[model samples]
Target: MAQLGIIGHKGRMGQALQQAIADAGHAIAGGVDAGDDAAQLADNCDVLIDFSAPAALEGNLHAAVGAGVPLVIGTTGLTQAHHTAIDNAARVVPILQTGNTSLGVTLLAHLVREAATRLGPDWDIEIVEMHHRMKVDAPSGTAILLGEAAAEGRGIELAAHRESGRDGHTGAREKGAIGFAALRGGTVAGDHSVIFAGNEERITLSHLAENRMIFANGAVKAAAWLIGKQPGRYTMAQVLGL
Candidate 1:
């Protein structure tokens, strides 16, 4: 069995991952929280899984590279600079980064892409997502992931054609734009729905997360798949062979 290490051992996801690691029959090399020595933990593990805050990403990446171990990053709310860092680190070690690690979400993304391609530009795409009240980021990363899939299928750039946080006095919806809406309340793990509206018809795709274990299990599976690989970036789709 592979020995795994966790970068964020105090959070909800981290706790779930601990159980998942055991369920998968993998050994826990160690775990590190905010002030812990991440480099030391990385050096002792066969693979590193990070569900930590975005602010701690650089140090985690450095630790993974320094130890020559593969890493799986499931942390959300990352910016462009963080992505650039991941890309740089990926050149030296195998790295898998994703907004949501659930296998169901990965399949959902594939279906969204297919539907968007067949529907064409006549259909307006809108994504809605809801999460637990404690979630800090708006629009949820999974919503953005679905939006990116739709944009890819339609051969458009999500950055240029994205819309969100619409309040009063918002003009008409732009053609070929992907819109997003976020809801936060109660203890919802996650809920995502993508609506494609067209003349006299509409199509919707959705996925609901009941708890944190789905993500944890998927992350463990992805981490296992990441071991013994050449230096490169990877994805949940690759793990599922989608």
Candidate 2:
């Protein structure tokens, strides 16, 4: 069994993760939340799992590296600086990061990419996602990742033609543009669907997360998998053998 330290111990995801680890027969060495110091927690565990906010990511990575414990990061909203920090940390300890930890969602992303590539530019791609009202970010990190997969499939840059919600007096959808839509209400775990519309038919690929436990389970699995990996960066796709 893997000895795990969970960051964001007070949050919903953190609590879920703790339960999932226990149910899987693993032991939690310690947990650190909002005001707790992550570096101290890292010292007591073989692996650190982060389900915290973007603000805490850098500190958690620093702590993981300092303690020589591999890390599994599920925090989203990462910026360029965070990416840089992750790269630096990977030089010292293994790290696995993913916007959505659900194994089904990762597989859905792969299929979306393949469909986008085979369908050609004639098909218009659009991504729609919905999450709980408490979600802080628009177009959630998972949506952006799905968009990136579609862009890669079409051999186009994601930044070049990304479009979000519009108001009045908008023009027709531009060629090669990928549209994104977000909806928040109730306590929906997550729902993402990619629509590919062409002149003849349409293809819709979707993934619905019914419970938060899927993510929690995936994170624990990732932490266990990172136990002996060499110093480097990894993704959920790699973890799931995609």
The lDDT for every candidate, in the order shown, is 0.95, 0.92
**Candidate 1 residue-wise lDDT, 145-210, digit = tens:** 999999999999999999999999999999999999999999999999999999999899999999
Per-residue error for 103 in candidate 1, Å, reads 0.4
The positional error of residue 78 in candidate 1, measured at the CA in angstroms, is 0.6
Q: Which residue runs does candidate 1 get wrong by more than 4 Å?
A: none
Roughly what TM-score does model 2 have, to 2 decimal places? 0.97
Local accuracy of candidate 2 as per-residue lDDT tens digits, 1-242: 97899999779999999899999999999899887799999999999999988898888988998999999989988987998999999999999988888889889889988998999999999999999999989898889889989999998889898999877989998999999999999999999999999998899999999999999999988888889999999988888888
Cα deviation at 92, candidate 1, in Å, is 0.5
lDDT computed for candidate 1:
0.95
Error of 2 at 136 (Å): 1.0
| Residue 155 accuracy (lDDT) in model 1 | 92
Residue 123 miss distance in model 2 (angstroms): 0.8
